[model samples]
Target: MLKRIGYTAGGFVLIGVLAVAILWGLSVGTVQFSLSQIFNIVMDQFSSPLAIDDPLNGPEQTIIWLLRMPRLLMAAIIGAGLAVSGVIMQAIVKNPLADPYILGISSGASLGATVAILFGIGVMFGENFVGIMAFIGAMAISFGVLFISNLGGRPNSVKLILGGLALSAVCSSFSSFVVYLADDKEGIQTITYWLMGSFAGAKWDMLPFIAVVVLVSIIFFWSQSRILNMMLLGDEVAITLGRDLHTYRQVYLIISSLIIGFVVYAAGMIGFVGLLIPHLVRMTIGTNHWTLIPFSALGGSIFLVIADGLCRCIIPHAELPIGILISLIGAPTFVYMLVRKNYGFGGE
Candidate 1:
């Protein structure tokens, strides 16, 4: 117990240090704001409704609030949502490698967004309709994966994985066909960018819905830590322990699909944080989700905030696509982890 507590504390502190680094990066961006100015903007946000203020507090306030702040928030929320869904999907399927993006939810969502943009569908919901359709597409893929795997018998972890890969290929091909057919130069450009992902679209209107969904799911999953721990032990073992993980796994996949749907709608296809962060947390905190889930969620949020900050400041006038950044970093790290083989979040 003491060891678990210690690991959790260490993870939280490490993440806190990373958070400070992220804030420093934000204040040091191309549009520089002094640390004091950044502090003042944060204080002002709490003290008043409008950022409408004195001229001396001008560009600093704008830089801190208008640009960097929303991006940071989106990064954090998307990170938490991905990590949380990763935890749930891993528990549900009893696989160390399961991630929403890997399991085809993201591909399905990309297809939905492409359809919405090209065909002029879902217009009534205005700007948000694309996200809604993406959510629908994601859930459809999730069920498709589940049902297809269950065709012969109860889905083992291997079968679930196989199903996800096949469905993901189908979705990707369909999306590619749509892009090919459109032949609209701007539309193709938009689709290409969306596939790479960005938090540059962050806005105040977008915050509440995603935040609440992520937070509520985090709380819900935190309470199920024991069940998740059992899930990792495999199906027969879980059954012996008197839990029917079949229904439970389905429930978790559905909930994760909902979260992933919303996240994909908002953030596009930022990948690997889900796969990488949980394993990193598990390496430090062990497989116990009680500590692991919450810490992983916090760690993920911190990671993305820092990553998003890096994406913003790395160039003078342009932003790096976050999906590319995560893949670039995550792939090397994943290879290192696989080669090292000492950390052991169940990878063989």
Candidate 2:
């Protein structure tokens, strides 16, 4: 009971931190707003219909509700999705080093974005053709990985990892080839920036779809916590217990692929969150997926919200790309975790 209470307290603390981070994200940026002003603006949304048009702070309301809120929400959603996906990937492959992009999803998305941006492919899909094509590419590569892995025998962890790596290499080569052939300098710069990642394009219109997808995926994975735990014990143990885990692994991969695809479509290629956030949660809480999933979700949201806020104000009149900033932080933090003798990545 005491342990449960402790976990509950930790959860509340994480949620509190996430809430504060959201508020901070709203208040930062070029046109800053005081906390009180932010409060009034938020309250105005729930005020009487007559007062709706006349906000407490009109300009601030527009800035917060229209611009910052959507971006911050996207950050939170993407962060949660990536973190949960990481947990699932690690469990699926039973490898501590595995991440959401281990299946070449990133490479596929990059290739799709590269094609759409440079060659104008998928333009018929609409204004967001780049993201759409990227999603398609990600899904295609995920299926391709599965197909390759299933060749000649039932797919296993080793086969899956090898398949992913091979497809990743192939997709990367194709993306590079496209870049080499395309002479559009502006397009190349756009690809570079998109690959680096940013929430600058986040809007209210795109949030609903991405948020629903991510939320549903997280819930699904959390529901399968028991099976995920068994996966760590290997196929032999799982079979002895009458749980195959083969189908479960594939299903998890497909679901995680959806999460990654939409994430890439919405926010470009933000890395390190999927790789770092799960491990951080594991280090804090025990590796039980029941605890790990929710905690990792909250932790990821907090990290990205704070990161996005810093990105807005880290330099005057210029916003930093979120992916670059996260990599800068994640790389060093990960190294520290690696060197720590006590941190056995949940193996101990």
Candidate 3:
């Protein structure tokens, strides 16, 4: 009872923090807006969705509604998706180091987006062609990993990881080769920026799709908490208990891949949230997926919102790639956690 009450209180606290961070995020960037002004604008917009003129200044409305809101929302959504993906992957592979990219999703998406940018494939999809191709590439590589891992024998955690790493290398090498052969300086720069990851491309049109995918995936995984618990118990133990985990693992992988595909398409390759957030939540709470999943989602959302805010204001008159900032912050924090023996990779 106490634990449940504590978790509920923590959830409320996180939601409050997320709200403040969203408002703070709106106030960040080149031109600053106050929280009260932002509040009024949001309330006014909600009250009158079709109003041509908002109470805030023209530029303020544009920055808050058109720019910062979508980006901040995307940061939260992407963070939650990646963190949930991390939790699922860790359970599927039964490995502490497993992350969203463990199945080569990011590399495949990068390859697809690169090809679309350089070769002009999938242009019929309109402005989102690159994202479309990225989604396709991510799914393709995910299935490829599954197939390759099963080639030798029954696919296990080690085999799956090896297969994914091998395919990731292949996709990366091909992507580099394409870039090298193209020799388009501008396109090369675009690819570099895309790989580094930014929420600058967030648009209102894309938000609905991203929101639906992430939210649905989170709910679905939460519903499967029992199976997830079983997965972490090892295949032999799971089978001894009259439950086969192989099929369920594959299904979970496909679902995770779909979540990651949309995220990569929406926000490029933001890293470490997947690698870091789940472990942080696991350290605080126990390994129960029911508790770990929701906390990780909320914690990850908060983490990314703050990260995006820092990225906007860290330098003078410029924004850094969110991916770079995450690495910069996450690497040191992860090291500290690694050195601290209190939380021994869910063994505590």
Per-residue error at 347 for model 1, in Å?
Answer: 7.3
Alpha carbon lDDT at 102, candidate 2: 90
lDDT on C-alpha atoms for all candidate structures = 0.81, 0.91, 0.89
lDDT of 3 by residue, 270-297 (tens): 8889989999888788899998999999
Cα-based RMSD of candidate 1: 2.4
- Model 1 alpha-carbon miss at residue 218, Å: 1.3
Model 3 segments more than 4 A misplaced: 51-57, 342-344
With a 3 Å backbone cut-off (N, CA, C), the pairs that clash in candidate 3 are none
**Ranking, lDDT, top scorer first:** 2, 3, 1
Q: Which ten residues in a row have the lowest lDDT in candidate 3?
A: 48-57
TM-score (C-alpha) between model 2 and the true structure: 0.96
Model 1, 134-196: lDDT tens digits are 888898999998898789988767787788899999999999899889888887787788878
Best by lDDT: 2
Off-target runs (Cα >4 Å) in candidate 2 are 48-57, 342-344
Worst 10 residues of 2 by lDDT: 48-57
In candidate 2, position 224 carries an lDDT of 94
Q: How many backbone clashes does candidate 1 have?
A: 0
